[model samples]
Target chain A: MSSRLSLRGFLALSALRTVNSLSRGTGRGSGTVAGGRVGLAIYPKLLNDLSKNRQVILVSGTNGKTTTTALCVAGWGDKVCSNATGANMPAGHVAALSGSSSPHVVLETDEAWLPVALEATNPRVVVLLNLSRDQLDRATEVRSIAERWRSALSKTAHDLVVVANANDPLVVYASESAKNIRWCNIETPWTSDAVSCPKCTQSIVRTSGSWSCVCGFTKPGCVASVSGSEVRIDNETVQTSLSIPGQFNVGNAAMAATALDVLNVDPSKSLTSMKSVTAIAGRFAVRTWQGRKIHMLLAKNPAGFDALLQSLSPGTDDVWIAINARIADGKDPSWLYDVSFEQLRGRKVWCLGERRLDLSTRLDYANVTYEVVNDLNSLPKTSDTTELLANYTAFSDWMQRTTA
Target chain B: MKIALIYPELLGTYGDYGNALALSQRSTRRGIDVDVMNVSITDELPDADLYLLGGGEDGPQRLAADLLKKSSLKQRVANGAHVFAVCAGLQILGTSFCVEGNDAYEGLSLVDVETTRGSVRSVGELLSQVGENKMVGFENHGGVTTLSPGIEPLGTVLHGRGNNGHFDGFVTETIWATYAHGPVLAMNPWLCDEVIAKVTGNNLTPLKTAADQLYAERVTSLSSR
Candidate 1:
């Protein structure tokens, strides 16, 4: 073993304690990066040490990671510890494991961090959710992320069971290296990123719901599948009464159940536990402002936006759409065109956020009439329910404002 | 007016297909009959006045370049059809470009330029001067292009890297290419007008909408800071 691996002792553990105390002394909040940064600086393999005896469940994807991680933790009630704050990096993983002594752990891992997180955690069940073009400026490309996942899965296939979405070709290509994978057919409407087969470079031919490539990379048999709201597993349908809105959440719940099933957790009980989670990290959360209870839904990328756009009832009150190209969101707001903003036609759309003009331009092209809203105070004070869809930074800004 | 949205499935990364929507609507607003043909990867390129190719990932980009090299996009452009492309679209219209670490693929060769991978990915709000008209759009590309002699650039870079640090894109009477992809035409209505007017052979009245105001606002905001 390497000298670093051999150096495990009270010194490493005490180092974390000292750093945590020192960080607390600095008067920073318990939630920031200081503690985790210090712990990893000393331990190096901090997550590996913390996750030694735990049954770790690492959920990573372009979308649905936070929600799925939340669902899995909710499934176990106080049994599973997780980074529920949407912090999906190494620091977040270290912090989550250090905070709770629960034998079970769930981590919401970023898509790019999957290989590193997988190596560190030695997870029991690794959930590979759908992949799509999200934050392309920073994430680079979805195919590159998939290739990384594939390479990592090839090495660690024997140690873990991968629960992946079969509906997404990119997800399938990434998880094909796994020795054991519970494939789930959770439908995602965005198919722009997966036209070219990830493996053979041949075009993916999707007839009905099934898909296949000429090089024989076809859709695998799904262990569990969600058709609209109904989830089917082992030829039996599970009536999932989710408090969360959108069919995507139903898919998330089904995916969580499938992942939990690997741990011998009752899928039905897991779904029941998931029913209590009305919102995930303020996603789909209703925040009252100016007498309007704005049902805020996060729709940052094209895939996320496509799912949210499906919920827009035709000819409803003015739908509020906000976009920001902050670093957290991709610096390039080009993906706005990939979304069907044309669906917002015949409805008065109120544009908000920093990229409000860019979005207005996009709407103008889609032939969707819109009004640029620079401030929340300018919102109409009608008591009618108003739905607001926003990208990552814009949504986070909204959360910050309301919470503050 | 027919607008061919070329290979959106293969080359539509960064919302590249939005260019077609922008072009079509901008023409329709001016009382022109517009038919936008959503051409997928497997579909044939329809006869159109203007064709748009957007940015794409490496594999799809290479595939799109290969497909277009063999397809009628070259012959169509030769026959007075206009082509507007971005990033990967810009690269694919050139003589050759590199992808997947130095593996060079032959391009459509419609434009006299070549692109090679660079260390720094040029990604930000790019401001440029396109013949007195200031163009504001987001540029996210890694390819540094070298233009052939006498090849005209779309604009001189005022802020971000276009073809390189100094200039933005290649421009001809029949072809317009750039790395700027807030769907180029949507961000710069004047460029769209130039393409539309060139094809229609008629002067267009300056139809101002929220898009134009947004363009003016973007140019002001992107320029001031």
Candidate 2:
């Protein structure tokens, strides 16, 4: 395919590169947003033109987009481009595709922006992950987003493949009208967002491993699934020995492996490549704090938090929960109630962050004892390893402080 | 004292359920014993000294209002049980409120008030003053409530939009309803103590601790911003 760009597209690409370099030269953080904005402002259809001839794969959902995108990039092997950072907006897409000459591109996308990005990329495969309430102060309701996805995917061409999570009712409902779909049975621990069927508003009946509603909406038969650390696709089973420590990551790997199968890639090679990815962006990074090895985990919503809590070892007790209510963290911390913190009934919890008081209050209701530490330096010294779970901005601050 | 948390599965969207936790913690801190009852929809409403309700989405809010209307919840409130309701809970306790387009549901009428959809949804940090006590919390709701004649306002809105853009909440002899839900009682310990005092019919001594300092800092930081 010829990589020819129109005059306006070429100008936008050139402007993006120049601004990116200038932004990095000054230390104004990553130039992804700034450059992408300039490029799109100049040429409105820059993303469409850049991705017209390339085979694009779009990964999107409420959570795990960054990690799943990284896995997909690893599965595609060499000569593939992707947005490795957490930037998933249109500007970020333009920035990632502007300088690459690769024919294959894997991109992470925001849930609300999936429809717009699908139109721009016209992707060969779209991975639909679980949907849940996230940043409700800034985001629309979960059902509204699902409705938008259903409409957008229904209008796509017949050959376009959709990889959806079968266990999540919302995902099944959203991709039901797709021409071709590969269902993956990824077990979801959070079901509050999908208690009512998206199709008929009836209560969903859930068993140990599956869910169905009286309205005829139910979990689809899976073409791909993950059991323990193994991913089963068709007649073959690939062992996923990933350094990332969570069943959720195993489920993500299964989704990536299935998407690779649609692209005619070897599942064994994809699993091998995925094992090399220990951390996506900065999530699941281990850091030493106060003479203890602390595993840092990021959970922006109740569903993500529930997954993290379920993945913890039975013996793991010492925990530090950090919360912040900044602009990027959605300002309203009312979602804390939705999270089941009762699991930490007998654990020692140290509440840290701008909203530590709010968390302390939550822990009090959970019948859990906790200590409020305003300053990180004053955090008590623990000999055993501890786990740190933080929301968006708090996670970023801790990563910057410990890594710097 | 026994505190019943009403329909948590349906009406526990925001951290409004934290109010129950706040009451338990504050009561324990004051040497007052309290038992918390988690009540679901299918279960019968248990009689208690106090009832706690939280906020939720429109569908669940309507379901809760319908369920509570059929039960004897109004008699419990009328018998002088201390009740605290937040956002959707406040709306469900009023005489009537709009749930969605062109549809309204009748509330338990525990308080003499009515609710309608606000012109714009209000979401932000809320600061108010109830008598000599300063109340701080977060408010996110679309219901605009109007109090009946001779009804008392919960507090005056000092910052951000409160109940109808002016008043923060409503209060009767034994019930309190408000849109401010940082689990209102958690951020405003004084209000929690006041509610407890009303239940036990005794003036409880206040204990100064780190929560007060955190509350003060939050109020300062949010107000200045």
Candidate 3:
């Protein structure tokens, strides 16, 4: 271990391990970050060895990376160790690497820290989730960050195998120098955004739920496509066909399948592992509260919010939009104006949080009916059956309240 | 009365589509039919009176540039279709966008000058002075945009970013592009009406509705954070 690793490190490590063990004490091994004593010193060497042997995969994006990383790790099984705790930054990544004893790691990385992480812990396989504008306060422009990744990968990668969203031409375009590239796509109808032809500047058109460019070029279909027919997601993990809803989830699945395949995992084995895939807590998870099932979907950005809205059953369900002013929540709530609140239709919307008034104003402007609540102290008593859409912090509080 | 919404994917960061939704609903109240045609990499770009592209991550900009290069979308832009490009859209529409030390990505010359993707990204509520009018919106972009000659600048820098001064959006006769993300159009109907008029060339008046009045009251009562 480096100078950073001392008795202090050991104590912290032991504490986390104890917590992990306690969390799993109830049985069912609720899946925590693996490896308890690798230490931060050995991480650089691990990265070096992995790079030399061509055995690392870095997946990063604004949303979906956590679930995608978990799926890839599950697909790799014991072969891959990862930062599964959704710790995506540099220090967190260090903790993840120290906690992993595997030869290869299929890690989920954040955009801002990917460059630094790659330099320190060079990964052979870099899986880039589609980039979306997020947390401009801490994150560089998406393109600038993408260019950094492109440059770093081109320099550090040996036999790079890149898996990208063909629908998101940005990812396709960014992995320009990958020695090998395999494409995955979220079947159309599940996607609201597609790239314009990079060559012609014309908006690429979609036909029958598949994407096609007008210049006589069609992106090769996904090796493993996640279509509505193929996917089976329900209220219960055992009851539902798949784990998560929304087409973006399908894309994440496709990305995971492609990355694991690059690692030489059998398609069928990977598919079977996906059977265990459950929605990450804040991403899209369901909790039964007093006999009523409540589904929580994190709506951080417009695309995420839009996807979450699209995946939800639009009806008379009580909804909540919790707005926070954290740098991560986005400084400005103006983008709420572009969101299609029409999806809510007759659904009740409760705009709550610090930005509640801002959201309420936009809702009013769109003529979308919503009630504003600044604090939960005065929350009206409702039936257990009420469905709620909430902001991230508000949702967290609401989840704690209801779950407890 | 069918309206087409173009390049939504590229410009969808910070809820750019919400602007389109606002436009669609506003038009719907006016009894106009709307079809939001999403032009992706698979199909040819459709011709629409109005075209909107919002801010997004870098990959979208490069891909959008490449796709726009292949399609005759630039020719259409030169032919004078009303275009509303914001943030990343505005950056990608330039002659080229520089990713700091990285190679510059070529852009459609719909607007002159270029953009330098900065290490430090700017994010905050932006208020710019347009003549005597104040344009308020959220500003978030990691690149600096310089306006070339012949392009009409939108407004003077008031708060967040000034044109070419870390926070000004480039403006042309029929095209309005900016880094300001907010219900930019929602707050400023003047710009929305201007785009609508340019696209349709018909001076249609915006009518007052219950939603509109309610929105006005809410705006009047909004407490800034």
Candidate 4:
């Protein structure tokens, strides 16, 4: 494949490697977007070129794309190559694809970029985890993304199977047009994003583990269900002994196992293989810092925040909450209000970040008491475990500080 | 005081429901009792002193505008109920608003204003001079609102583009509307208190908390940047 490339294609693939190696060698960029940028600049259709003749599987949603992709990659073992780093864009896709000539490739696509990925990759299977409002500055309207997904799903090949979340009405609406589908009822708790039906302009009524709209947009009967810690697919229920902290990961595992089943992988082997991935990038990573055990969770949006908060509540622990409004994190921090901050009222909280004031104002309105801090050194030495919950760049900054 | 949080399922995008929390907490801080009714789409609109609406997507915004037009909201506003709305909430309160490139929808007509598609969608930090105090919040919307001859704007734009890039919002004795959504009330406690005062028919006492300090810091930092 490399020997028969045109002059531009050869240069683009070569440039991808040279730039990635140089960027990683220098401390300027993390080999995430730089190399891909240069490669795509030389060859506009670089992604399509790299994806040809490979069995592609796309994992995309508002949250857990990284974890779900990692689980799928781990399930396939050495046979699959993926963007293990948190780079989920076109450049990153091209760069990741340049690493190996493996016939199987799993890509964690961004929510808005899913339709683009669908058109580019023509994936054998599309995994729709869930959709909620995340980066409002970039993808402001949740329903518009659903509309695009509806169109993209309708246009895909009839043989293309979709592993979707039946718990999320938005995901159901997006995956409705797929001919081959397997829905998973993982009991997702966040319903703030989709209370209205997308097919018809009517209110959606949600019950336990299911929902229905008056105009007949109903939650389809799923093949997989997460009961307690076990994922039941068909009649076989396997206990998902996942090492991750939150129930959301249980949902991700269920979806990954179901998607792997579509790829003809054994359910037991796929779910077991997924258990090896305890932390995705820096998410759910814990380290000892400043004489206190610090647990770090990358919650970048309201959906993530709600999931993380829901998992770690009904207890008392001082949490260091950090927020940043950098371009990667979406410049608009207005979504902070979408989060349920009132849950943190009983816990002692510390706030610091680029946008701590905005976060502090949100906490103030929730009537939660918190102290503003300057740095990690100011953190009082305590016996109780202190957690670091940060969004995007704040997580990166804290992860860097702790690692350094 | 009865405060109605209207159609949260339809209009609670961008944390617009935080306004109800601000109003309730401020009222409680002043030793004033208040009832916050979270009105759903199917529930009948309850009679209340103040009605609060938040931002939403275009589809929900259109649905909410149609629903409110048929509801008792216009009658309540005529009977002197204080109303505070943000973004889509504000858009649905006007006479008419443009959406989806050329489609227009009829607003609730509570405010003598109209909205049209702007050259660019206004996003990011918004700062406006509200008489002596500068109000700061975040704005993300596509429509630019224009006032009628006899109407008044909420404030003049100071930093970000609000309304039509010169003015920030629409205001009258009974209605307060804006495109800013720092949950606006949480970012500007004075505006939250003022709405409560107008609805309760009692002057609010000087009550300070963590919000004022943070508000001052945002205004300072955003101004310098």
Alpha-carbon TM-score of each model against the true structure: 0.95, 0.91, 0.68, 0.96
Better-scoring candidate (TM-score), 3 or 4: 4
| Native interface contacts kept by each candidate, as a fraction | 0.75, 0.41, 0.54, 0.88
Colliding pairs, model 4: none
> Interface RMSD of candidate 4?
1.5
Candidate 1 interface RMSD to the true structure? 1.5
Candidate achieving the largest lDDT: 4
Task: Tell me each candidate's RMSD, in Å, in order.
Answer: 2.6, 3.1, 7.3, 2.2
For DockQ, the strongest prediction is: 4
Candidate 1 ranges with C-alpha deviation above 4 Å: A1-12, A18-32, A313-315
Q: List the candidates ranked by DockQ, beginning with the highest.
A: 4, 1, 2, 3
lDDT measured at residue A266 in model 3 versus the true structure, 0 to 100: 62
Q: Give a tens-digit lDDT track for model 3, residues A1-404.
A: 32334555555555544545665432333223432223233333333332333367888866678888887877676656677667676545544555555666777888777777677665656677776555555556555665676776676555667776666654655665566666665542323333444444356666664556667645654444555525321111111145667667666766776677667766556756775767665546666555556667677666667677777775676776777766656566665655667777677787776667667657765677788775665555555545456655666765786662
CAPRI grade of model 3: acceptable
Best by TM-score: 4
lDDT of 4 by residue, A155-225 (tens): 88887889999988889999988888999987678788888888876888987667898888899998998
| lDDT of candidates 1 onward, in order | 0.83, 0.84, 0.63, 0.84
Off by over 4 Å in 4: A1-8, A26-32
Clashing pairs in model 2, backbone N/Cα/C closer than 3 A: none
lDDT winner, 3 or 4: 4
What's the count of clashing pairs in each model shown? 0, 0, 43, 0
User: What lDDT does candidate 2 reach at residue A220?
Assistant: 85
